[model samples]
Target chain A: GAGVSQSPRYKVAKRGQDVALRCDPISGHVSLFWYQQALGQGPEFLTYFQNEAQLDKSGLPSDRFFAERPEGSVSTLKIQRTQQEDSAVYLCASSRDGYRGEQYFGPGTRLTVT
Target chain B: AQSVTQLDSQVPVFEEAPVELRCNYSSSVSVYLFWYVQYPNQGLQLLLKYLSGSTLVKGINGFEAEFNKSQTSFHLRKPSVHISDTAEYFCAVILDDKIIFGKGTRLHILP
Candidate 1:
């Protein structure tokens, strides 16, 4: 079976531009997660979705970030205004049993803000 | 809130030699511990996890981790590592519905 996948593996955006990263979770996966990995650091939680209903979003840094999983399978993380500090790899993960199941990760989308 | 701490930022060991990456967490209640490995230009892969019962947990690629409740630590170890073992390792713990990760330890396999 295919693992989780993210689109736009690499993206470069101007400081004020907006960007959207996509994620495709494995089929039938009910839980999805988004994380931000800064250079040389561990991944930080961003947001999570359980079948289209976002359960936890306290990890979101600020109002500039927004996410949606309308159909419960595909998700998108949108950054309103890019900043140099926003440069990092955005990872997406999915699991079958919500929080208890082991998560499967995607290659991630590396966003570089210039 | 729960937090994880990885004592070492980087560790270098010769190929086929033993290696250990230290991790400690702060939590008042029982927790689930996990070790994940990230290869260059790749996503994270789960090496192993410790839910309960056993203090010693074995994982893929011959990697293992021990859960020490008294020490509040879960350190990863490999008796003999291959060059492929060189990567970033993260120790994580489940907090409510989310996970908290440590800064990560870079394992450098020296030839």
Candidate 2:
């Protein structure tokens, strides 16, 4: 079975540019999560979605960050006006049993803002 | 608010030596504990989890951890580690429909 996967393994963008990171969760997964991991730091929650409904966006750092999962499978994290502070690895995970189930993570997309 | 703490930032051990990575959580209610391993250029992989029942839980690559309710800790231990085990380990706890992860510990393997 294919695990969670993210596209564009690496990305480089200039400050003020917009960037979008995509994630494809495993088939049949009902829950999806996005996290940001800075250098030498653990991943911090960004947002969460259950099916096509966005349940939690409290973890998102600011208004520039946005996420959506319309079809209930593929989710995208879009950043408007990238900043140097947004340079980090963005990880996506999926679960079968919502929050209680073990999360399966993707390889992550490393974004660099210059 | 729930949080996880990884006491050590890094631990260096010789190959074939025993190792332990300490982890503690700040939640009194029943919790789900997990250990995840991340290689240099790979995604995080689940090592093991303690949801309920037996305190000692075994995981892949000959790793195991014990869940201690009294001390509020879930420390990962391995009798002997291999060079392949060199990676970043993260301890996480689930509460309120969210999973919080510790800073993570880097395991350095020496010859």
Candidate 3:
């Protein structure tokens, strides 16, 4: 579709298991972002990419979380050695250009760690 | 640094009644204000944004917001609400590429 799309709408992982979430941003969008939303909370920024460069990732809770957009289109968020605290909905959004006020978002991937 | 505050965690209104969701923000530099809506089991969609121009902005689904720079506030409103409008609303600000979001306000439409 024209909007952003995410894979594996839902995921369940055991403690110590690694998980990967994929996001396909809108065609040719210049800016992409990842955010984590816990239950009853708003989304918190995780990382952002302008083209193929990761400019900021300060919101990433720990080193266990990593994100990449090697081709500047499809991106992946990886969580290594996941713990219960890692459970949340992972959201992906994209803007037509850098610093654009409007952004398109995907349905998001719900991750549950047991 | 930028931050958004949604004072009301939950707001209830009967169908067809008007409702308002309050939001406040703070930023040292130039910023953009936004309102996002999230349905159950879904991600967030932009409802409206205040970039530049008129203080009032209109968005999809009969939603509107007024940007008050002096008060640092952007509150979302709908003249009439529906049960379908029940969802979590988030207020956010874009400051130098960082989007700070509020905890959100859940709009409960009473039948």
Estimated TM-score for each candidate = 0.97, 0.97, 0.95
For residues B1-111, could you state the per-residue lDDT of candidate 3 as single tens digits?
467899999999999999999999886566788899988876688898888899999999999999888888899999999999989999998887788899999999999
Supply candidate 3's per-residue lDDT for B74: 92
In candidate 1 chain B, where is summed lDDT lowest over 10 consecutive residues?
B92-101
Query: Which segments of model 3 are wrong by more than 4 Å?
Result: none
**What shift in Å separates residue A15 of candidate 3 from its native position after superposition?**
1.1
DockQ of 1: 0.74
Writing each residue's lDDT as its tens digit, candidate 3 over A1-105 gives 679999889999999999999999999898999999998888899999999999999999999999999998999999999999999999999988765547889
- Tens-place lDDT digits, model 1, residues A33-87: 9999998889999999999999999999999999999989999999998999999
lDDT of 1 by residue, B63-109 (tens): 99999998999999999999999899999998665689999999999
Candidate 2, residue B83: how far the Cα is off, in Å: 1.2
Model 3 chain A: worst 10 consecutive residues (lDDT sum): A95-104
lDDT of 1 at A47: 95
Model 3 residue B34 distance off true place after TM-score fit, in angstroms: 0.5
Question: How would the docking of model 2 be graded?
Answer: high
Candidate 3, residue B12: the lDDT equals 94
TM-score, structure 2 vs. true: 0.97
Which one wins by lDDT: 1 or 3? 1
